[model samples]
Target: MSVVKMKLNGKAVSGDVEARTLLVDFIRQYQGMTGTHVGCDTSQCGACVVHVNGKAIKSCTTLAVACEGAEVTTVEGLAKGGDLHAMQAAFKEHHGLQCGFCTPGMIMSAIDIVKRNGKNVSEDVIRRELSGNICRCTGYHNIVKAVQAGAANM
Candidate 1:
């Protein structure tokens, strides 16, 4: 077994895991950070997205060992001082979610989108950048709107 150490949601955490263990499993199972969901183990769905070293990545397909000493941010990490992150607030206000199965990853990816594309991200860019993330709920009208609104507030 390989011992992997990483900062998870601003907390230092370590685990003894097999090299074949996926980061999603390490987060949810080992670290008990269940906010990062696993919709598709094949990486087809972006439901397992999380921030690793400030970039969004599919944790389901990412190796835990590869994330050793990395900074990992799950959905649970967004809020600070009991206040929801701007993106999360936007999602709630804009009604971006339905069943909420994909909300965590969607929010995570949205934050990354805002960070990479800047605060003034357009609707077209938001839609295109979110191509990897699928929402089987709404037509994504609200999700897009929330992303754009959240981008401005971020």
Candidate 2:
């Protein structure tokens, strides 16, 4: 087992995990944070995207030990005192989700995109930024709208 110490959702966490444990498994199984879903084990699907040190990363592709002393933020961390994050609120207001399987990762990625960019971001820019995240339900029409709206508020 390897020892990992990291800041998770504004809380300091330390644990011992098997060497092969993925970051997604560690967040869900060990930390009891299921917001980071494991849609595709191959890392092709961005369903397990999360913020590591303020950057997006595929939790399923990252080793738990690799996150030692890192700052990790999952979808669950997006809310504060029951109030949704601006991106989540914008997604809901713009109908950016369907079956909701990809919503978490989409929001995570979108938040990072807007944070890296800004409110004046363009549709084509959002589409290019969201290229890594796949949404089978919305067809990206409303998804783009959601990102733009979310960006405006951010």
Candidate 3:
């Protein structure tokens, strides 16, 4: 086992993990943060998306050992003082989620999109950028609206 240490959601965290352990596995199984879902192991589904060093990445495709000393932020880190993040609040107000399986990843990716594209993100741009995240429900219409609204708030 390899000992990996990193800043998780603004807190220092360390755990022993196998060399082959995925970052998602380390976060969910070892760190006990289940907000990062594993909808697809193939990395096609963005359910395991998280912020690594302030950038969004598919956790399933990333290795835990590779993230040593990195700053990781899961869905659970979005909220502060029991209040939802702007993106999260927008999702709720806009009904962006249905089954909720893809909500976490969607939120994480949306935040990154807004950060990169700025608050005035266009609908076409949001759609194009969200190609990686797939939501079986809501057909992405509400999700797009939520992202736009969340972007404005952020």
Candidate 4:
């Protein structure tokens, strides 16, 4: 077992985790942060995406030991002072999700995309970048729209 210490959301956390434990499992099981979901263990599905030191990453593919001393931000961290982030608001405004299984990761990735891609996000580009994330509900059209809208507001 390895003891990993990291900042989860905005709080300090430390735990004794097996070396093979995935960051997603560590976050959910030890930290009780439920917003990070594991859709596929292979990391092809970006449903388990979270921010590690300000960059979006697939937590399912990331080992907990690798994240020691890092800063991890799950979907639960996006809200500040009970206020939703702009991307979160846009997701809700555009009805970008149904069943809501993928919303957390989608929102995290969308915010990252907008931060890097800016407001001129094309639908095709959004779809291309979001290829790794699977959404069974909206068929991606609304998700793209939501990202575009969110990008404009960011």
Provide the clashing-pair count of each candidate structure: 0, 0, 0, 0
Q: How accurate is candidate 3 locally (lDDT)?
A: 0.96
TM-score of model 3 (CA atoms):
0.99
- lDDT against the true structure, per candidate, is 0.94, 0.91, 0.96, 0.90
Q: What ranking emerges by lDDT with the best candidate at the front?
A: 3, 1, 2, 4
Tens digit of per-residue lDDT, candidate 3, span 26-122: 9999999999999988989899999999999999999999999999999999999989999999999999999999999999999999999999999
Please write out the lDDT profile of model 4 over residues 20-120, one tens digit for every residue.
99999999999888989989789887899999999989999999999989999989998888888888989999999998999899999998888778788
Best by TM-score: 3
Model 3 spans > 4 angstroms off: none
Off by over 4 Å in 4: none
Q: Estimate each model's TM-score.
A: 0.98, 0.97, 0.99, 0.96
Compared to the true structure, candidate 4 yields what TM-score? Answer: 0.96
List candidate 1 stretches off by more than 4 Å. Answer: none
Worst 10 residues of 3 by lDDT: 129-138
lDDT of 1 by residue, 30-147 (tens): 9887898989788877999999999999998899999999999999999998999999999999999999988998999999999988999999999999998988979799999999
Off by over 4 Å in 2: none
- Winning candidate number (lDDT): 3
Residue 88 in model 3: shift from native, Å?
Answer: 0.3
- Residue 81 of model 4 has an lDDT of 88
